[model samples]
Target: MIREKSKERLVISEFFKPFLRILQIFSCYSPVPASSTAYKMYSVVEVTLLIFVPCFLKTVDVLQSFTELDEALATLLIYVTFFIYTLKSISLITQKDDVRKLVRCLDLDIFQPRNTRQRNFIKGQILTSKGILTLFTAGGCFTCTLLDLQPLLINRQERNGPINFWYPVVNTTKSPAYEIAYAYESIVSITHAFTHCVLDAINIICMAFIIGQLHSIEDTLINLRSYAEKEVNIKGEPNTTEKIHVQMNILLIECVSKHRALRRFANDLNKIYTNNFFLILANCMLALAFLMYKMSKAATLDFTFIFMIFYFGTMMTLVFMCNWYGNEIIYKSGNLHTAAYSMDWPGTPISFQKNLLFTIIHLQVPIKLYALNFFLLCLESYISVVKTSWSYFVMLTTVSNN
Candidate 1:
């Protein structure tokens, strides 16, 4: 048993290593590596670029004569989203202890997959979702970077850098200064993309873990009848009715406790991510609206139009994944009551039957992920967001045309 437990832990750790490495780079308090002097130095530099570059650009937009208000607002939205994620990462770091405690609570033998089929199913689900999201993120970053550098590559005499910012130097177009600024912007952009990808990946991973737990619980409940029978038998001798009753009562008590613990785990997980999910949903909707407006205004074959389409698609896909997985948790949890009902409870003691009845009633409500307790994260909410964004975009386009 000990060896199997150790192996299970090792396998889980191996599965999480890639995400943990990414988290360590972007988060100060991740368990993979705690804060060090070098990490702090790197954090300082990254944070500065993330926060200052956007502010500088906004300021330049305000000062420049030909700057478009909508474009400036779009840029501001992007930076604000980044800023919110940065703060979210810092908040997660401070709650590392709580996160560790939650994980420990979930580290139960019952949660492990029971067979090769179950194990492979969980592995495949996680890998396939992560792979798709990673590919989309990487592709978006590549396309955006290429577009940003298109001016410099196509027109050698182009004076403007890839991104517009208010530099202290007067001759930002000249050599040395231009090269330095270009390098700085490129580094900042790439780092920002990396941070975005890591944070998004972490969200998906958390959802996957929750879904896995739900699956484990379902499996345990499905086999509870045989487990109870085994508990009542002693040394190949059939137990008395009273003895079986007592043993079954004990088994039901343990199952109830496990159920409560799983609920608490889900609640803690929800609390940690509630605000972050809310912000992501809210920001994605606004960005989608803005992107639609930009796309509608751009020429048919313009680079801006093409880029907006890709950006919009990425945002929609991400929001959909989050909602889809969140809804799955609710869907699977709702089935637990049915599983409990299906258990072979005939001829059981009245007390055992009562306990099973209570379990059924409790699970009817189903566990859910909520955003700030205001909106439940589900497919319905995802659909509403899409509709709202489109309505907003249409309104903006109508006003612009007039």
Candidate 2:
């Protein structure tokens, strides 16, 4: 038991590593379940689960769904998960914890963080604030504006019904609840995406800072070596070599620090897209809502939007997910317990071919998932154009058949 406690203490020294271990234990194998309270990182792991549980249980019409520990419990879990993460945030601000200081100690002080960290920090702020805004937006303006979602909501029971493969349109006359829910989910997703992106940016920034610092230290060492070479005539070759060897341990320390950063960066990115792919999930939900609405009419405009959403969403999801592989490998190489930059895609081993798809995901994984909110604006462009364009000019909304 003493040895076990010491082992636990050693592992818990890292900030987020403990939380990751908990996750591994929770999902992998363990008897009687582990304490959910045993977390250190402010990850959305809990939030993601919460978002799913309550909704899933509510749909199944089971009261015990709230109590059960299964994947089917969606909404309840979603609530619980978010609640936990929020609790962590609150704790971080309120506690006497020293994790941040510990991280500072562990961090390489040689390099400087990239702009990515600031950007990510900003994004996190936006998510925290804008997600709240999104929540309100999903609730609608509430100006006593009554909307009929029936025109847009799709009936899921239809068999062999024409489904749109392009852009999706939803009627706001009937399926208001689902639409509202979907919109709210979008807010949750975007917020989460922003959070993850911000975290990545922070990691990058920290890494850049560390690496920069290390570079300077390396330069100093090189200068010292040069000086030592010049002094070899006086100190003798053996004495000069001895002095160089004396600084060897410091060099080794710097090298280790550099290598670990690279490896951690890669591993973190490889898993990034999947961990925070909620934005795509939100988009997919929006597409579903649009599909729900399009089913009531034979119009192609609605179907086009559906197709566009699916096509774009799927492609984007695939791109984001697959990009992680290259990122992981590159970072791994950079942090390879040695000082070397990674330069290959699907690199080093042929076996990584299977992981090539993931590498692509890593490569394209943007630090800010919502940096292209303009595209989101474009998505909504269909709502206005399709509804009003026919009376104005050459109706492009009527051009394609979904």
TM-score for each candidate, following the candidate numbering: 0.84, 0.30
For 1-402, candidate 1 gives per-residue lDDT tens digits of 011122343144455557667766654345633567887788676556664455556456545533655666556545555565566666666676766555555456545554454566556767877787788678658756864675576565867665556666467788888888777667666666656656666557667766776675565566665554565563344767666566556655655665676677778878877877787788788888878777776788666567667777778877888898889888988898887788777888787889888878887878788877778989999998999999988887876677
Residue 273, candidate 1: Cα error in Å is 1.5
lDDT of each: 0.68, 0.32
Q: Per-residue alpha-carbon lDDT of model 2 for 1-402, expressed as tens digits? A: 001111111111133343324333323111222325544232235444433332343344334344532322222323332333333333322321232433443443322222233224323432343343333333332210111222234454331112111112543224564455445444444443333222223223333333333333333333433333444444444654455443333333444454345445434432332322333333333433333333223355564344433333332332233223223333433333122222122122333333433333332322212112322212333333233322321222233222
Q: Which ten residues in a row have the lowest lDDT in candidate 1?
A: 1-10
The alpha-carbon deviation from the true structure for residue 76 of candidate 2, after best TM-score superposition, in angstroms, is 18
lDDT score for candidate 2 against the true structure? 0.32
